[model samples]
Target chain A: EAGVAQSPRYKIIEKRQSVAFWCNPISGHATLYWYQQILGQGPKLLIQFQNNGVVDDSQLPKDRFSAERLKGVDSTLKIQPAKLEDSAVYLCASSSRTFGYHQETQYFGPGTRLLVL
Target chain B: SQKIEQNSEALNIQEGKTATLTCNYTNYSPAYLQWYRQDPGRGPVFLLLIRENEKEKRKERLKVTFDTTLKQSLFHITASQPADSATYLCALPTGNNRKLIWGLGTSLAVNP
Candidate 1:
């Protein structure tokens, strides 16, 4: 089976500009997630979706960041009016489910490296 | 607020030695803790997971231990090789939420 797939592995944009990243999860996976990893920091959860419904997005910057999982398979994370701090790697991951002792491991994509000037 | 922390510095060890990494957290009791390995310019790959109820979990040469009372997890890689060089991350599922929060990670370099 194929692993999660992401587009535009690298992106460069100026502050105040907009940028978007796409993700295609593994087949049959019901959960998708977007995370931001600043240099020398861990990936922070930006949003999570389970079958087209948002499971959580408390960390997403409502003012400039938004994400959608259309039809519950693919997801897109967008940032408008990017800031210098937005220059980080955006990672996408998916898992079969989030319940039970066997909490399935999340399969991640290559991630999109964003450099905001 | 919840926070996860891993040693940010890189660890250097002999190829045949054992490598140990620590992850500490506060303000949450996670049901499970997971370990992931990431390379430069790449996303993390899942390595192991240990639940609160379980003391330890092992796979191949990897071992993970979860201590609920101490609010920490320890990951160990035995018989390390240069191929094992990478950043190791620790994650804990957010309380009542379906999200997993990760630590900054510790870089390990097993030299020959």
Candidate 2:
């Protein structure tokens, strides 16, 4: 079984520019998540999806960040008019269980390292 | 406000020794806590999970202890090796138990 896959291992953009990252989760996984991990800090959840439906996105910056899991297998996270504070690693993870199921182990992909100049 | 904290400084240990790391939290009663290992520039990999009801759990050379009363968890790697050098993270469930609140992580270096 393959683990979660992400594209563009690293990215650099200027402030106010737009950037997007992609994620392909493990096969048969029903839940996907996007997290932002700043240097020297733990990952902060940005959004979570269960079978194409959003389960939680309360921490997402609605004004600048957005994410979608269109077909339930792959997802994308976008940030527009990016700020210097947005320079962090964006991680994509997936789990085999449905949302609300506790004790599920999440498999993570090699995150995309984004730098905003 | 709820908060999770780990040792901010890196820990250095010799091979064959035991490495112990701590995770402390405040204002939250998580049902369970998780531990993960992350290499530089890579996402974290799941390592262990200990519940509030369980005092201790072990996997191979790794051991985890959870104390709900103290709101703390301890992760230990026994017979450590140089390959164990990495950042170890601890996470607790949020109020809803649907998401996790994470700690900054403690970097560990096992010297040969």
Candidate 3:
């Protein structure tokens, strides 16, 4: 079985430019998540999706960040008008829905490292 | 606000010695705690999980303990090796929500 996959492992852009990262989760996993990991800090949950529908996005910076998991498969996270502080690793993870036997033991992707100048 | 803190500073230890790392939290009671290992330029990999109802869990040479009353978790690596060097992260669910929150992580370096 293949693990979660992410594209454009590293990205560099200007502070005001926009950038997008893509994630293809493990097969059969129903829950997808996007997290921001700043340097020297733990990952912060930006959004979570359950079969293409958002389950939680309370911590996301709604003004400049948005994510979508269409068709309940691959997902994308976008940061517009990126700020200097937006330089961080964007991690994508997936797990079986926490409803039955499968709890939320997330499997993370390699992550996209973004550097804003 | 709920917050989780791991001893983020790197820990250096002899290859044959044991290594212990700590995770502490404030203002929230977690249902369970999890540990993950992250190597340079790679995403975190799950190592262990211990619920509040459980006291300890072990796998191979890795051990994890959770203390709800103390809002902390401890991770131990026995018979450590250079291969064990990496950042260890601890995480817990937020409130009644299912979203997991993470700690900054403790970096460990096992020297030969």
Which candidate leads in lDDT? 2
Steric clash pairs (candidate 3): none
Of candidate 1 chain B, the 10-residue stretch with the lowest lDDT total is: B92-101
Give the 10-residue window scoring lowest on summed lDDT in candidate 3 chain A: A95-104
What is the C-alpha lDDT profile of model 2 across A8-51, one tens digit per residue? 99999999999999999999999899999999999999998988
The CAPRI classification for model 3 reads as: medium
**Model 1 score (lDDT):** 0.92
Ranking the candidates on lDDT from highest down gives 2, 1, 3
RMSD of each: 1.4, 1.3, 1.4
TM-score of each: 0.95, 0.97, 0.96
Q: Which should have the higher DockQ, number 1 or number 2?
A: 2
Please list the residue runs of candidate 1 whose C-alpha ends up more than 4 Å from where it truly belongs after superposition: A98-102
Error of 1 at A5 (Å): 0.5
TM-score: model 2 vs. ground truth:
0.97
Regions more than 4 Å wrong, model 2: A98-101
- Residue B40 displacement in candidate 1 (angstroms): 0.7
- Model 1 per-residue lDDT tens digits across residues A1-117: 999999999999999999999999999999899999998888988988989999888889999999999999999999998999999999999998756544568899999999999
Candidate structures ordered by TM-score, highest first: 2, 3, 1
What is each candidate's fraction of native interface contacts (fnat)?
0.79, 0.77, 0.77
> How many clashing pairs per prediction, in order?
0, 0, 0
